[model samples]
Target chain A: MTRRRRRLYFIVSSLTMLGVATALALNAFRENLVFFHSPSEIAEKGIPAERRFRLGGIVEENSVAQGNDGVTISFRVTDTAASVPVRHRGLLPDLFREGQGVVADGSLDKDGTFIATEILAKHDETYMPPEVAAALKKAGRWQGE
Target chain B: MANWHRLANPTLFLEWSRRVRPWTGVATAALLATGVYLSLFVAPRDYQQGDAVRIMFVHVPSAWMALFAYAVMAVASAAGLIWKSPLAHLTAKAAAPIGASFTLLALATGALWGQPMWGTWWVWDARLTSVLILFFLYLGYIALWQAIDDHARAAKSAAILALVGVVNIPIIKFSVDWWNTLHQPASVLRMDGPSIHSSLLTPLLVMGAAFAGYFVVVLSIRLEREVLARQVRTLRRVQSRG
Candidate 1:
């Protein structure tokens, strides 16, 4: 090919490749954008119990319970307006505790329990983790301290 | 455009970068000193994490600079390829090691933060994995240029590679939100506004500014050195041919 022809080929091929990659990225992004939901959102949407999602809120006071087997644990996660019961079968983060914020990644069972595969406990003096705080602010739930 | 070619003349770039070099260097030094002081001494201890949050001032800025440098390198590569400008390739080449250094800094600092808070030194989480890939991309880019003896061909191939690799940028950015990684989701770069309190925000932004200034200063130094080296190479080539 001539020099101009080669230059044209390079431009054409690179742009096409970039275009295809971008399309794929956007499609995957749309499908995979996991939106975090609060208890109040759960109440409103009635999101199917089978759908996986992130559930974030403050762990309600006096709602934590140790399982009889001694490894499993359960608690009620609250967003000041509503609460969802969550259960997990693993060691929680060092910062996990009642009255602190938490984000549990899991799917809900038919019985309305959030079966968390992973639990991230909130840290900091504020009631919310930074991500939770941002999400809360977006949802208009943040009461600035 | 022809204007792009004129702007990329090596002598012109060298002179321009040299003229601004001292200003950028002094500004970067001043900002870095102020940032370190504010971050290390002025910022209040986290109510919970205490002194550990100070790592944010370094970790966050390094990550941002890593991303920014990669972006600069990629843009330079594109400009060089599209405009047939040799100086643009040199700019991209100069940027690679700087980006790689920043990526390494971010990773090491992240590990330090993790060991104390998360109780583990490392995990093969998505966010971590993507950053690791970005670091490798920088290394590969630098290595590709070095491995090729023909500078023009090297620029062409490496520029194409850089363009192809840019897909990784968005992946690195959204990894936390897309996956349930051990890495925490973004607090500062969020749609709902930064969740960090003002006390932490102040130092973080200042450090970010310092890092950007440092990149400009360092990049100009590298670019000017490359231009000088090219002159030496050209003189040798003419002598050998004669």
Candidate 2:
């Protein structure tokens, strides 16, 4: 083959391999790609029954309740416009608290309560996780808290 | 086949790069402009994810580029080794730092996005760990290139290291799938349909294209710079001989 043809072949094959690698990476990570939804959106559209997802907002003040089992804790998460009840059975992160930004991952129960498999305490007071901050900003409720 | 060696001449490579660099730069800028707009404003907030999903716009593309750049470096290294092509050596050398930068960006953005979403700044999860290793590999490749004093010897040694390290790329990619980890599995480029909504997919795609364009633009520019430096070195050698 001519030098130009060989170069063309090299470029084409390299790009093709890149395309394949991307496809593979995306496919492999599909399930882990969780979307973070605000409470209002979840309430308005109604969360799917079986799909695992995430909810992020402030933990509502005075809404945290420890269950009789001691290990189980329940709380309400809100984004100011709406609130969703969350039930988590684990050690809450140190940063978790009422009026603090938080994200919970799990599925919605039949009764519409969020049964969290994981609960992430929103970072420090000044800190907003980029995703949570962006989501809030887009929703027009971001007050930089 | 004979003409392939002609490109080894630094002057010829410089001339070719001059012809290609402008178009790549323009294309990169245009793609990035469209991508940022689409990602930040046009794409609908994910029905499930809200606006925070926007992080994917920057995070995923950088990750893709990190992997892509490493592959480019590995291939260039292989070419240099087999053909003793000085231009290939320079191309691989030029690409290493850029690849390392992208890997760093990917890791940092992923951490920033993860802290709020995952509730932690770092995780030992399979996917995250592998990416961390990939970053280290990039660092090692760059260091290997810099540590050796003889340019040709350094190139040859680094080429071997890069080719060997290529094995880690597949391992990194498959780690999430093969092992249970906190990191999410794939979404857009899947065997099945993308799990994400088209609204989000559109922006993600635009951003990914923009990243690819950016890589080409930067690679071309850096390649041109390397060619010029090579020309200067040759001139210095000739003058010393005279």
Candidate 3:
């Protein structure tokens, strides 16, 4: 009985210690752990023009435009509070559309336009049938853009 | 205390487990058949994703089982280490490979779904990275068992590893919420209830239950083999002594 008790205490204490150490480490590296920075975060932090970083947000409605050459695309990514104009010269993902979440990798241009080297679509957790979605839209209950 | 000790006996454990093993096997087959039918034929297509949403029936269930199996292994390891229960160690050992398979399935299915939906095959986001670590932990636990010749020493070492790796479970679960991952947040499991519509949610849940039933069936079979092997080893030792 005493041995079992000792084992229990040891395991519990060690797990606690490990948990605390992990918490500390994660806290220290919190900034580095984020997969991408939102437009709002970038707007507040003001990333340097030369520093390459991923910019993520929803593609603002009616902001997508094609360049005269038809090879380049321009869109404004928005987080409701802030928006960033991004220019890309490549194929976009099939899911890329107006009012959809997107993450772009590149650096800011001299004119503050984001030059995207690559782009990825972001999916939301919501899943429903087209009819239900249409009904939600009609009812003004659809949050998904 | 007496009943607890009796329950710990490998022979008794096997006898009781045998009664339930066949039932679990049947349940797994039945549930999986119905789940597959519902997922493929009955579940409504997503408004945004269309028919591509069908992947969730398999991917979500495999991902769920991956985490569930690890939890079982961790708890059993802790019990074995604390109470000196050989059956607990065997249970943990039996679960490792099954859990690893589920983890692999989840990763593969996620990649398949991500390619067209997210436009990437893989990323080092927090949620994805943590699940990959879980797969490695399962591998490490299984390798530790094979590396040691002595059964007791092997069980002890693997138990420690299993317990230490338990920390990854919560991290994998909440990584999307805690970090800016491309992976979507929880839809089925949340404080506000499932965000997914019932048409899709029903099939996903049925598949999840089927996977759980499959785990129970496989665990029982592997555990029976482990117990028999131990008994044979002990019998040989006794004969040599005589």
Runs of candidate 2 exceeding 4 Å displacement: A1-145, B1-9
Clashing pairs in 1: none
Question: lDDT by residue for model 3 over A1-145, one digit each (tens)?
Answer: 5755655555555445445545544653565368899889998998989689889999999999999999999999999999999999997877899988898989998888999998999988999999999999999998777
* Model 3 ranges off by over 4 Å: A1-32, B1-4
Across residues B181-205, which tens digit of lDDT does each residue of candidate 3 receive? 8899999999998999999999999
Interface RMSD of 1: 8.9
**B-chain TM-score, candidate 2:** 0.93
Candidates sorted on DockQ, descending: 3, 1, 2
Candidate 3 residue-wise lDDT at A118: 89
State every prediction's TM-score relative to the real structure.
0.72, 0.65, 0.91
Per lDDT, the best of the predicted structures is 3
Lowest summed lDDT window (length 10), candidate 2 chain B: B44-53
Which pairs, if any, clash in model 2? A28-B186, A29-B185, A29-B186, A30-B185, A30-B186, A30-B187, A32-B184, A32-B185, A36-B49
Worst 10-residue stretch by lDDT in candidate 2 chain A? A122-131
lDDT of 1: 0.79
Fraction of native contacts under 8 Å reproduced by each candidate: 0.03, 0.05, 0.59
Winner by DockQ: 3
